[model samples]
Target: MEALGTTSLGERSPWQDLPSELLGLVLQRVPSHAGRVRLRAVCRPWRDGARLQPPLPPLLPLLLQRDGTFLSLPDGTVHRIPVPDGVSCLMSTGTGSMLFLGHGDGRCSLLNPFCRDTTTPQYVDADCFGFQIPSGDPIVHNVRKVVIMSDHIITIQKTFEGYNCALSIRRRGQSTTTVDVRWMPHVAAYSFDAELFQEKLHIILSTHVGTIDLYVMDLIKDDNVSLQCILSTPVDNLFLPFGHIVDRYLVSSGDQLLLVKQDICKLYNKLMSAQFEVFEATDLSNGHAQWRKVDTLMGRALFLSAGCSMSLPASDRYAGAREDCIYFLCELGCYGIRKENLSFGIYDLRKGTLLSLPSETMVAQQGPQIASWLFPSNT
Candidate 1:
């Protein structure tokens, strides 16, 4: 009948006396996923506490390069992880995972590097999508860009004939549906980027005359999938000269859809500067939508690149992450010169200030290295 911490018990362990809530707080303060994993290994109670309160959004984004190096943000600590065999290059990144293209046969797989888990390799046939590249040709080497949504995959390729885009939609217990669209010289229906919103695919199209258009497609429909133009706007004058280097990113934020247009410029195979503009979709009552220019993200931070486009709240839990800003990693190519390089920066929408990341912490490489933001996985 003695109390828990009475003299009969002598001296209790410090960790045992610590409250669970306080232990959880301590675990939450550890930013790196590996750090949290080590903390959980200390004891059963610590593991339980770590599992109960996983790091929330605004968690520091990790920069994963094609060479299997993970550069942690805010602090810029570098860690090397083994790349899965046969992964030649990075294609796209999803929630807590990334899609990579195989070096041998152009097969793709979804890999969660933190947990070292991967999905079965699946071949993405370009001929099935639209363009008929030779059987021996590597699809990843030919495709200009690849995007992966929940169950859909989109690829844009430049063939000898012209540029074309293909959309493949696959649902559980259903066969995949593929759609191919060719870019016409005078038409403005070419897709630049695509994202899923409310289960429907939204595509961003560009014209030769600097016009930007948004088209929505219904993938669930049984019949042919046709794109309906929702919004059309013109690019600003400043972005006109860099049209060849322009890339569009479509991101979904809650009930709203965001379009990020970025232009990266290079000088002598090195990064020069980058610019961005964000727009939010509104209206949509009578088969029509309007895109309004927005300067602020309202406490949300966007990480954008050719590999992925994602948004998370810039919460206070993540130090050095500012709200209403964008963290960008993109490749800048100089037309005709055939030179390009990667660039990284943080752009504050409110003050219109662009700041470079600390160069000393960046990974030193001889050539351009592909970078994508990898979010922490619960697994």
Candidate 2:
């Protein structure tokens, strides 16, 4: 009989010695963030091969602290990542391989974490800017969010003057997404927030009248991708169109579009303190959808910020994460960006209550919200 992990000839099993190319191919199929963790634990060769994979898919979201430490979720794992000097992770690019990083010289570059040297960076050909960054353009100064998706890149920029804003959706290869601009008479006046749902790009546009509209860009449609309005504030019957609305986030939950409304409770230091309300879309099949207040998120949890938001299922592995809760950051402005001063909290949907991060967890994080939320590509 053949011995364990051995052939009839008594040779050692070759399972540990797979080819690099084949390993890379296998790694591509591993979509779950948690699944990757188990994949690396198989053996030394497997771990090494997984690490050597060209572009590491973003693992479960981590809070990037001010001092280059990573605070992982659910497990409360504290990791000190060796980030290079003068380079700071600016935000997630919606992909695991590259991120938008900021330098000391007011310059920003695209950083691929899997690359050999974190010290050096070059320009990424995102090409939506059409102009060099740091060029003193008012538009560049107020750039709010830049999300890189599979088909196109979405850039949202807001200027303080009259709350002016613009949404530029550009395809990767020198073209632009066909947006339905007939409704938007003036791009500068309309302020909006966007997210991806069901393989489509969705956005929430807030107008001066206090009304908000939800629109979706159907990329998978025919040859021409077009934007279509799905719902508006009046139809939702939930949002009252408050002028005090400062930030609204669109989080795509499992087959659900969740809206997180943040209203200004207090204005201090040119920033407004946040108060939140959750709403879930209803009857989406007919295009004209309505919204209803969502008291719970089932077993899923949400991570949100001014610029980004993500939803994930709470599992046993993430012991620190609470189910049906929303996790967010607040600017305490006490220690001037110290991790301790950046107040983090988990809001319980069931009880409509909030619980702050424990003292130990806060201390592990550095004070920074550069990358608003790190969403997994698989999601």
The prediction achieving the highest lDDT against the true structure is: 1
TM-score for each of the candidates = 0.79, 0.65
lDDT of 2 by residue, 89-127 (tens): 355554323455544344445544433354224433323
**Per-candidate local distance difference test:** 0.60, 0.57
lDDT of 2 at 374: 49
Worst 10 residues of 1 by lDDT: 331-340
Pairs clashing in candidate 2? 65-366, 66-366, 74-318, 74-319
